[model samples]
Structure formats: C-alpha cells, structure tokens
Target: MNNFKPYYAVIFTSTQATDIKGYLVMAEKMENLAKQQKGYLGMDSARNEVGITISYWESLEAIKNWKANTAHLFAQQKGREQWYNWYNVRICKVEREYEFTLE
Candidate 1:
C-alpha cells in the first residue's frame, strides 16, 4: 500500500489462455520494468481462475508513459495474440483507502 494520498491505480483483470507458454516470464519482466519506471509506487497481484493485478502510480501521465513503453507494448500485443483469453484494464484515482490487520 502507498502512504501518499490521491494516487492512481491500474487494475488489470485477466483470464489466462490454456497455452501460457511465456506468460510467467513476461509477467515478471513487466513487473521489474514497471518498478524501474518513474512515478511507480507499488503493485499487488493474485492469480487463480482469474488474475488481478493492481499497480499504483503517482500520476495519470506516468500511467500513460507506462502504457506507451515499448516493452509493455510488445507484451500487450502478445497478450492479445496469445496469453490472455480475456482481460480488462481500469484506471482510477484513489482518494481514500483503509485496511485492517489481524494478529
């Protein structure tokens, strides 16, 4: 979670195709590349029948830059051609957030 207020979240929901050939490697690569990008805050992801990845950013412009990144573009093309059977991406401004911890 990010401490800063008014951050942006890119919520990526995906369902993997049966043939996941290079999915894991590409996913890891993208995550590492995203971490090296400007305005990148953090990311949390989970996978089961459906996969959900939420990545936090400092601004919408940063998100745009990430979307336009060459490597990411190639990954996106591959996702359309192979990896993902279905996917949806949503970008939102996070104004307020709260969480609880159990010990």
Candidate 2:
C-alpha cells in the first residue's frame, strides 16, 4: 500500500547515547503502537552515525495524539533520560512524493 494524498510527516533525527540498553526494544514497541494509531499511514527508518525515522500521518491532529500517547510519552522520557544525546523532531506537510525502483 502507498499514500499519494497530501499528508503529514514527522521527521525524527537523533544521536544515540553510549548506553542504550533497552532503546531498541522500546523503539520497536513504539513502531508497533504507531501502526495501530488512527491516522498512521507508514514509516521509514535508518540508522548509521545519525538515526532518522520518518513517520507518516494523515493529519496534524493525528501526530499530536501520538505525541500525547501514554506509552509514547514514556518512550520520550526514556529517550531523553537514557537513550539519546540529542534529537530533533520536525513536522511537515508532505504535498508530493516520487520514487524510482530497480527490480
């Protein structure tokens, strides 16, 4: 499935702390929870020296709801307290998208 309509994208960029023991588990949990949310459309993630995760949403309200979710709030706290050294979140309207694939 794909979204061709106008939507919202939450871009999360971060650098990890040296001690991130439970971070991966919590991240996976959050991903699953996000999939179950009201306006969740899709997500893409990659990590190298810097981690970037873009979560697609149907609307700004949906994004706000996710940010306010209990479990997500806990994750956010954990991220600040233990997992991330620095992070930035940007919410933008995605008005257009295009891709090329080689199969």
TM per prediction: 0.94, 0.95
Model 1 error, position 1 (Å): 18
User: In candidate 1, what are the lDDT values of residues 42-103, reduced to their tens digit?
Assistant: 99999999999999999999999999999999999999999999999999999988889998
**Model 1 TM-score?**
0.94
lDDT of 2 by residue, 1-103 (tens): 8757899999999999999999999999999999999999999999989999999999999999999999999999999999999999999999998989999
Clashing residue pairs, backbone N/CA/C < 3 A, model 1: none
The per-model lDDT (C-alpha) reads 0.97, 0.97
